[model samples]
Target: MKPAKDWHAAPLPADEAKRLRQLRSLALLDTPQEEVFDRVTRVAAELLQAPIALVSLVDEHRQWFKSRVGLDVCETARDVSFCAHAVHSESLLLVEDAHADARFAGNPLVTGAPHIRFYAGVPLRSSGGLVLGTLCAIDTRPRKLTPAKQAALCDLAATVEREIVQREAARETLEVQEVERRKLRVSESRFHTIFQRTPTGKAIVGLDGRFVEVNPKLCEITGYSADELMHMTFQEITVGADLPADLELVAELLDGRRTTYSFEKRYRRRDGGTVWIDLSVALIHDDEGKPMHFVSTMQDISGRKHSEEVLRGYRQELERRVLERTRELTSSRTALQTITDNLPVLIAHVDADLRYRFNNQVYRDVFGVEPSSLHGTTVRETIGAAAFEHCLPYFARVLAGERVAHEGIVYEGAPNRMWNATYVPEFQRGEVAGFYIMSQDITETKQRENQMRSEVMLDALTGLPNRRALAEQLALSIDAARDAEVPFALFFMDLDGFKNVNDQHGHDAGDALLRQVAARLKKTTRADDLVCRLAGDEFVLLARGITSTSACSRIAQDICRAIARPFEVGQSEARLGTSVGIAMCAGGTQTSAEAILAEADRAMYEAKRKGRNGFRFASLLAEVAPAINNLVDRGSATRH
Candidate 1:
């Protein structure tokens, strides 16, 4: 608490430059007072029983107060500033009485209003180790701070230093967030422009024909705000005369009978006005082919309907014009080129003759040809004969007025990826015309699913096959023995002294020991053998084509010896043993995995009962029991 010996407050001009730079970098000068800094000053004043306390920063030409308890002035000239001397000092500046000190004996601050007599200031350093300013206590009457009070004042200064540095870091974070907001604004602007392009109403509808998202354009067409529309379904606002046909098409889209279908419909708006709109609807699906939502665009078509009514009075003159419009309808289908071309999925239409009629941009990206250039090409010619023949049957089904959604087809054109596709039959005048083909690449989804399945079969602690994997292999082995009359052996093993090792050293060390044992077991077994951990300290090995008594017995001995070796556990070595029991099967009529496993388990305990590290054979097949007995009689019992 007392100032260190030989330490004096001497203002160095060279150090002042770096100190002032660090002070300004905090951006705390000439600002309103903050409560974090004010709280510390208040505590310093109360604990010391002083009249004035401040968190003062030394600027280039002035000493500014960031937080002041009783001081009236916010700043003072640097030459007359008492805190300026503490800004470059490694230790605090403690002046018992400014009037008695030779440095400030005749200073103006000692003779003027609000005169200073006692000053104790501690340097607040930046994280870069440059002193910025001081947390000071002042009184008009001469006094001295006790050792405990000096220590308390230093602790308060440390609090102010922490707040200074953290505020600077927070400012940097705000700058980063501002930049991210600017980028987000630009993205939103682009979306707004596209959303308002040509559609009078745009929305994302749920499977139940309820609005999930409605753009402002839709809100304008209907007299309801976006929030009010959310609670109401599209069917509720539709004119009842047009409701049945609209519901029918929606059903067809949901049932996979069509990828997309558009029709003119009338809506009963909020004011009870009938507004006709050309509504284009398409269903969106997840990676598993489940419907997620529907994206719909509605364009005002009240004028078109009025024109149709007038044209019906001049039927002969309108015949040629009607044929031209029919051609456009057959080509553009709802004029959805803007939407379909932007979609990530591959979409195309084919005629009854299997000739490609239309395709979106994704088709060109996949096939390496312009979609327009491929318009007149047959499906077989564009996809090549091999892929064409594979899809021919599905095309026949679609052309027969059936909808098909397939996920198992391995398209030769993209052999490295999986695909999900929907074929929707396009009908004209009660006959099948062609179909719309929509496909999406689903390689990543399938890969993730396969990874999850593999993790389930693996032991997370040891990276060995787990009990589930062992059960699968055991089933296969039993079926092979029963049907093909082949023979196999199952080894039931439990590590000796493993529990004692865990109890003495801890579970973490036991896990380390188990991983080492698993590595050794894998090395000892043959490549065709299956090694897996059942649960804590219990393991199973399925060794195929090892039915001979001597072969199976030697295999068990090798496994026992492998596990008997000392394992390096943490900083120490742990010694453990194994008790192994072998169940040999050679195509007996009563051979079963459960019966063999139980017999092997009993034999394993028998080996443990005889001594810890040893192997015993329980030949479950009646044909092999006699040979196994002879081997036992030949003094072939192994014990380590």
Candidate 2:
């Protein structure tokens, strides 16, 4: 068992004393409860479902209740006052269960007297951002509030605030009448009011530079209390180097030489840190025109100074990088010249007007023009008019930011040899400035176009078409399917248990297993179907003339059964299943090879998730676009 908390007044806000002054100035203390206030509390008590409601004013030693309903007391000591704690909060202080909160548990209010179990209050504030008191609700039982109820309570609190502001305005009107008799007194009061509430740091400095008066904003900027500043002179906290210039300005102001002065300087904080401030000062004269005080205003500019320094560093670093890039480009131009000259190719830089900028050394041997002399010469002069006509179409493409590659007898010059030319666009700030040409004499290679290059397209282990050949075949098949008004299906397959076969039997057996799987796939598909080995144990099949999904499923089922048969490898037996994903492509559909490959790969993983040795459609795991879904049959495009 723990003893009850004897004292829980809570820590006060920095403006607590000023708030107390404002609360007392309202002149509502110890007054009889009025209908204006009781009417609001009556609404809050009923709307919040609380037993008691009060418009509580917190004084120096106690919370005095101006308006109350469902409660007997008019006042409670500050030590046991919930409104006293609520006054420190900027907004509502809601305690669902006072008995469960460590700060309020076992307090006198919960253990005796009102026996408060639930408490909620909204801190009433002044125009100067000071919390004066709270409009509170009290309950004898532990309870909770919905967001709607809490909002309703805030609306009720706003009514109480409007009533308080009206009373304060009336009191100010009376005080203004009394101060109007003395003009200087009214001016001084207004000055004090602005000095306390202004966001900028301000102070009244004595002529002798000794301690005078500092506002809360100044104290906040210098990280010092008003008491600490009052005991010290301005010179005590100013940076030593800045003191001389500041004193010169202050002297001129007093001697009627300068009316005001403004400058940027450093001020030393109490914590031994320096802060940059934009300081502006003006002379204040009292009655009879005698210079009285210097009113100094300061704004913290440390953040601006930091950002300027960072921007300067970034600018210098960018300049250095630009210089480095220039040197690298110079070296690369020299290296590219040497490399292009060694190859049997005519390389040149041509401007947008079709005139040459420069040419490689090979141009001298091929075109009978010196590399430097080729500059300023038109392509019609070097390669003849017929070649320039052929080059016009390529120029349009490269200038439009497309790289063009073609090989034919376009340049019908003296030798009349076929040339394979690639035009690469040069860009300056995202615009096509010009282009560089790399033309190789591939006249011999074109003669062997009809030859079958088995080394490039055939798989060495499986004797099937590899990925390079598969790409060419797939493109042809897609065009054929679109022209013939038929469809094609792509099957992406992956071995499931093949890793075990490789680990237990070794790489030799794994190679043999893949070769056997490829042969099985070839035997399982139709004569028109193309079985291609993509990479490792993964294979792809392109079956054109596919009109229905059932036909594709039949082919996948046959391949899966063939691969599941037992294999013989180095006197050891191993088995692995296959997962197939089919990507259905209907006729006249504009589908990219990459999109189809990705779709099939994702569906293959879905098939793996459905216990292996199974096949799934890409549409089962991915959403097909409306255009593509409309092209294919519903059975092939049904989303899972």
Candidate 3:
């Protein structure tokens, strides 16, 4: 055996600092063995026909096994780990005869216990492109991995990566949800404090407009005790002129036509004198869709109203001053128009009748209409049917004196655009006269969010739906099957002898084979059937609306046959078969996606146990949880 030359003193990767951070983020260092990870290592060892397999995570000073199929020790020093070197490699690091390799010939791992002879490793890369560790197979006897076996090893490694990424995503989602929940709690606390302690009159009224409960400030404002206020309706205290209009709004609320209404009105105090108040009321509903109560807040505005009346007595002098003020207002209007026209957002005003009163230049630029010509035109006529319909409900709420904010897609011009719009009620003499509209183009932002979502749900290598997407599709299929009262089948397939192709020809050839296989699987399935690459050589097909178990068996057979055909990659032709297991959901039955997939997985292993290149079907009624008693022969399944 050649003496090892500074193998323990190998230089760190260039991105070592960033890589360590990425590894730590997974929170998996020194973690106990998990079945999900252990299964991958077990499969790797069985398929590579190696005695030992490990899901190794390389830490700063040691290599820890998240899963160990044959090794006794839970971890080893980084200096002697074959995985340390393998993590730095982009492709599989294979040492057919470790004693012949200078790097490991005299290493402690090779010279001491276990006496490692053969090794093949594929780096476990995080979604962010950092190499965290490796999924490796080792043997006590010297042996080379066929190209197909190498590919199978790589596939197993990819599965480990998928598990890591999915866990990370789920953790992040939980963190975000926790933050939102905390914020909600804080907001509720603040709202409660304000509602109880604010100086404004606050009360809860029944559907009859009579106070059901009143705060201290409300009693002070009405010159009555809380007990007295509870007996008197708002209509009884309101002056005659404002009473009828307020009652009409209450009627709208009762009919569920409006959520809120605000207005200024006079209330006759206990002393028989009138006081003006600005009042806002919102309807609350019970869980069973019944009107529960209304929340009302009122601010005394008697001083301001009195001052306005005093100024009205000087009408002649006020009229003379108004002439000068009108000129100043014109200049201010011009300045405001200049600002609005230069802004990137669309700004406009529409009356209660939905007629456009005014709009900025940006409106014309986006909608391709003359801003001046929009005056007195109905919104439906100006923006066409699609955009108008999108805004109609919000428009109704705003015209009813409620503020509305929403996001929607506007399909106009060459391509559709996303927008965020806000509508605020405009008041004339304390009544809703119109609404001011502001909309910002959010197309770029929306597209970026969609792209991120797509990337998260797709497999970067094979361009197939990843496990996350498969789970979602399976859930949808389950729902559809239950709704339509029909049966559906899930097929779990593992490629036979894919590792040999990776071992002989190279990982590039292995990748090409996977992509080709994915394409073939997609082509073989019906358009409505979902085909997903779960991880590595494993793929899942969801056959929705299947009629019977016989149909599922035939589909599974067809897939196995299709995959048995030789794959042409460049100058080489590699052949691989499939072991398929199918699970069917009966009509009108309730079953979760996880339950169905688990059944299919069990059946697939049954096929592998029986022999490669065949199909097996298992129903929900079958006993699917039994452990495998023997390992399948890896050499029997091969790529040319």
Best by lDDT: 3
- TM-score for every candidate vs. truth? 0.45, 0.31, 0.47
lDDT of prediction 3: 0.79
Tell how far residue 135 is off in model 2, in angstroms: 1.2
- What is the C-alpha lDDT profile of model 3 across 362-443, one tens digit per residue? 8777878888899999888867788788878888899888977778648464147788777778778999999877777788
Native RMSD of candidate 2 (Å): 28.6
Give the poorly placed runs of model 3, Cα more than 4 Å off.
Answer: 1-333, 411-415, 484-486, 621-640
Q: Which wins on lDDT, candidate 1 or candidate 3?
A: 3
- Clashing residue pairs in candidate 1 are none
Off by over 4 Å in 2: 1-7, 184-640
Worst 10 residues of 3 by lDDT: 625-634
TM-score of 2: 0.31
lDDT of 2 at 476: 67
Measured on C-alpha atoms, candidate 1 has an lDDT of 0.77
